[model samples]
Target: MRALVLAILAALAVTGHSATVKAVHAEEREGFKVIVHPDNPARELERGFLRSAFLKKSTEWHGETVRPIDLATRFTVRDRFTTDVIGKTRAQLRSYWNQQIFSGKGVPPPEGESAAAVIAYVLAHRGAVGYLPASVDPGKARVVPVR
Candidate 1:
């Protein structure tokens, strides 16, 4: 029985079934809804700015320090946000940040452990920006459209 199970697992691995499973899991996730501190006046953001801000290339927003928060790389919502807005995959991001650290360019934004933590961080910080699963409610926070 053990040998049969191992053989089946090896077959699945050899056939790329794991990638399909991850693809479907990511699709099932609702993706991210961008949220900002309620006091943030900018109602919308340019997508390019998000890429820069998240990368720490643009560090200020409206005279306040840009605090870009993120979900851990394991989350599917994070994958969606990175692909849709940041224009990089998680592995690509890791490589980019690695080079940045090596050259002292900058560091990637901090990551929240959970969706609620992300929302709370946004609410507590003055210039905080983050995302949550689309169905998650960001209490008293503003949803900024990404243009």
Candidate 2:
């Protein structure tokens, strides 16, 4: 049984499944949730998909342009989201965005001033998604399960 478990872990590490697992575990530890517009049909998301979306690599969802939102300034949940979901430290993410911008490749996502603003952005934009601490009220935004 131990050998089998180890084999499975090895396979996951080689295939990058372990990173997704880590993302899930990280969010659980961070106590944050991912939210989407109420109109979006996605009830769950893979952590990698979210990382791609936030990095602006995946720009559409369900025929709508994906609108990945973020907090305007540093916040605990923002830090957690970047680390757990985006897989980058805040400074790393900023440097990434800086490189993208310098090359005229992309820009960071729209940001909200507060949790309420984030919820409002999601509620107002059909393809929008954001993350907030679990303690925050999500208003009409639909909380999506993340793996």
Candidate 3:
């Protein structure tokens, strides 16, 4: 029985089915910068409020419409933001948006093709909020700490 169990474990490892494998990629856990238009007025945000803003629950900030922007789903920074900030996986967010659309509630944030695009949009719009890799320079946008 001991030999059989050992062999089964070996097989599972060789097949890449180990249950102990970590799901998060190293790059995907790296920090992200949450940026808003410099004129947005808000300086900081709680994690819950940031998540709600991203999820489209809190639609306004200081009387101005809150426009949230997302990086493309395949971006590593976006994965980190979704996991650490929004508290959802990409697939889960997609499903949630689908449900919202079918219910006539709302749609997910518009996706930026790249970090530069996001930065540009935020800088150009008064209510824009978005995320980028921590390494990126935010240009004219204000970086908001997510606590």
Candidate 4:
């Protein structure tokens, strides 16, 4: 029985059916600088700024009178990866933040439906900042870089 088990295990390993996993690299995209409407009078973020700016400052919303938002849409890269980094699902992100808002802990950022919508909101409001896929062309709105 022991011999048979070892033989099966070896066969599975050779056939790529073993539990051994392979690592895949994430596709890296060029980063951008995040900017706001010129008329808004808020400062712009340099390249690679949003990650720290958005996640670090709890008082950020109070400063701008608007909360920070992220790309948590179902198909967005940030949406999928954030949960793995923070141990929470997207639904949990909304639910947990909603609970906080109810308890006056902190306000949650607005949820966007798509990248374009997120970008539009950020451009229109001085308080918003978000990332876009590298493929997107940077128009008048400020672009922010990502890893």
Tell me the whole-model lDDT of each prediction, alpha carbons only: 0.87, 0.87, 0.86, 0.53
TM-score of each: 0.82, 0.78, 0.81, 0.49
Superposition error at 123 for model 2 (Å): 0.9
Model 3, residue 127: distance off in Å is 1.0
lDDT of 4 by residue, 1-147 (tens): 999999999988786752332211231123323434334454544322443345433345425744455655554455433443334555776687677779876665565676677777777877666555556654666653333
Query: Which has the better TM-score: candidate 1, or candidate 4?
Result: 1
Error of 2 at 66 (Å): 0.3
Worst 10 residues of 3 by lDDT: 18-27
The root-mean-square deviation over C-alpha atoms between each candidate and the true structure, in angstroms, is: 5.6, 10.4, 4.7, 7.7
Error of 1 at 7 (Å): 19
9-89 in candidate 3: lDDT tens per residue?
998888685332454566566789899988777878888988998899997888878888999976877878988988988
| Clash pairs, model 4 backbone | 31-145, 32-143, 32-144, 32-145, 33-143, 33-144, 34-143, 35-142
Q: Quickly count the clashes in candidate 1.
A: 0
Given candidate 4, what's the lDDT at residue 97?
68
Candidate 2 is scored at a TM of 0.78
Which one is best on TM-score? 1
- Model 1 clash pairs are none
lDDT of 2 at 138: 87
